[model samples]
Target: MKAIVTPGPRPVTDPSALLDIDAPEPVLGPRDLLVEIRAVGLNPIDFKVRRIREPGETAPDILGYDAAGVVTAVGPEVILFKAGDEVFHAGQINRPGSNAERQAVDERIVGPKPRTLNFAQAAALPLTSLTAWELLFDRMRADPDEEETLLVVGGAGGVGSALIQIARAKTRLRIVATASRPETREWCLDLGAHAVIDHSGPLDEALTAAGERAPKYIASLTQTPRHFEALVRAVAPQGVIGMIDDLPPGPFDSLKSKSVGLALESMFTRSGQGTPDMIRQHEILAEVAALVDAGRIRTTLTEVLGPMSAATLREGHRRLESGTTIGKLALTGF
Candidate 1:
């Protein structure tokens, strides 16, 4: 098998940040599926991990999360899928990732790929979809019948895009997203956001101008600490806010005054700890696939860099670090 790996955490600008090399076939566990990867998706976590060395780590680490592929074999305990079954998953953080020709993934966290999409498109959904779904329904506990509002910050990114479509299709929350540019604002509206506001300006005033109320729930997709105060002012009393980004130095005591509840949505939590509810990810991805096939939601993939190679992946990393991409980036074929 061929794999891309980093010798250790290094700056993305470093010439040897990532390299392609031959590796052994992955070994499987009782509940594992050995997948022949057809495509892989890139996320901020890829670059973040590259920039910071993990403590006590002595070997090169394979770094990827989202992947879509065909099952080549299954472990003895696997029942949900078999050889030749098409699947997609965000593999566990503790295990070697999917940036390879083959990977061993727990079947409990894998789901059937959307029938309407290609491998690149399917690969783009898993990580972001799980993050958005868990943040909205699991962490915030949104009600489908409630006529509340959801305010999404950094609305043009992958997770933000997924968050908007899911909230629109599955809940009655009036969706409001923040985008700084005209094209990004239009993209959010086209994806089912009821209103699009500019995060570069005052969020509260933008919400008011859009004829929306203080949101009952806020999904801060990025720059959580930078927008903390504004989020506190823009949320209704007793509201809940969820974030999936790194929070900089700041005090959250203001949330206490408003009875605001805060939560962090880390998609890797279930697989990282081998939780009892780990199967929930499978259910979530299965539901997302149905939504895609039904035309309720679509893939966020915007760029497909050629084949899976170290050079192409490095360029993809540069694009992500530039912070100008509108949606997800993927690479197809090994």
Candidate 2:
């Protein structure tokens, strides 16, 4: 099988950060399914791992999470799918990933692919969708009917697009997304954000002048430290703040006064921790697939790299690092 594997930990500029290699086809095991991967979505974490290869780990690490593919074979215990079943999933992070022509993924976390979407389009949804779903529903404990104002920082990115749509679908929360440019603002609004605020200046000031009330549920997707102060001001007392960004070392001074509940989302935690509800990923993803088939939610793929290769993957990562991509960057067909 042909694969793009990271040779070693190095700067992303180094050619070895991602290298094309030919390896033996992976063998499937019990409780696993062999998927012929068709499309893969690139995330920032892929580049982060490429640049910071863990010590004592071997070279040629496989580093992808979001994939849409067809099941070519199934293990003995796999009753959910058969050969030639189309599937899409963000499989367990600790295992060998979906960057190769074939991957063996646990059946517990895999979901049926949305029939309405193509491979690349379907590939763009899993990782971000899971993160947004967990952040909104699990961490914040949001109720479907209780009216609340919601804020999603960095609304133009992959997870933000999913966050906007899922919040609208699953709850009555009125969502306001922060985007600095006209294109991004338009994109957010198109994805179901009730209002868009420019993140260039004070977010609080923008909300105040726009007559938007402080949000009770805030999803901070980026620059957590830089936005913490404004979030404290714009977030209502006894509100909820769910962030996926790394908490920088700084004075958490405002947290003391705001009485806001803080929570973090790491979608990998369930699989990483081997929790009892590990199969819930398959459940949520299957529900989301139904939503996609019903046309209740749309794919967030703004850019499609036609095929998988070293150059295309690099461009995807570079564009994501530029922080201007309106949605996900998806690469299809090996």
Candidate 3:
């Protein structure tokens, strides 16, 4: 199998940050689906893992999570899919990833690919969709029927794109997203955000100027620490804040005064801990696929780099690291 891997955990600008090489076929487990990967989505996790070396890690670590492909073989214990089933999944973080021509993923975490989308489109969804779903429904415990306001920070990126659409499609939340640039702001609105605020500006001032009320929920997707104080001020008392970023050193003790709740949403938690609810990812992806097929939502894939290769993957990482991509980036075929 052809694969792209980092020679070591180095910078994306490093010549050997990603290299193409032939790798042995992934070994399948009892519940695994051996997929012939047709498309792969690039995420920040891929780049982060590439640039950070752990103490006991080896070279050429495969680094991808989102993939859309066809099952070429199924493990002996698999029941949900067959050899010819089309599937999409964000594979486990603990195993070899989806950066190759073939990958072995647990069937319990995979979903049927959206029939309305092609390989690249479907590939762009699983990871971001799972993250947004978990953040909104599980972490924040949002009421789907309640008319609440959701403030989504960093609203032009992949996960933000998914979050806006899902909130609009599945809940009554008045979606207000943060995007500094005009293009990004427009992109968020197009994806179903009711309003766009500039994260680069003062959130309180922006919300007040826009006639937006204090948000009942905040999805702090990026720079959470930088905007933590602002969010604390802008969110309604007793509001919920779910973040996916690493916070800077400090106590979030301010959340105490308002009795505000905090939660962290890491999509990998289930697989990372071998939790019993790991199959919930499959359920979320399936729901997302149904939404896509019914035209209630659309794919967030805005760019497709060429076929999977070291150069293309590196360039994708460069764009993501620049923190300027509007939506998802995918690569189709070998």
Decreasing TM-score order of the candidates: 3, 1, 2
For 64-158, candidate 3 gives per-residue lDDT tens digits of 99999999998899988999989999997778788899999998789999999999999999999999999999999999998989999999988
Compared with the true structure, all predictions reach lDDT values of: 0.91, 0.87, 0.90
Model 3, C-alpha of 166: deviation from truth (Å) = 0.3
Ranking by lDDT: 1, 3, 2
Q: For residue 233, give model 3's deviation from the true position in Å.
A: 0.7
Candidate 1 wrong stretches, greater than 4 Å: 54-60, 248-250
Which residue pairs of candidate 2 clash? none
C-alpha lDDT (0 to 100) for residue 59 of candidate 3: 31
lDDT of 1 at 55: 36
Model 3 poorest ten-residue lDDT run: 53-62
Residue 70 error, candidate 1, Å? 0.3
User: What lDDT does candidate 1 reach at residue 98?
Assistant: 85
Stretch of 10 with least lDDT, candidate 1: 52-61
Evaluated against the true structure, the overall lDDT of model 1 is 0.91
- Count of backbone collisions in candidate 3: 0
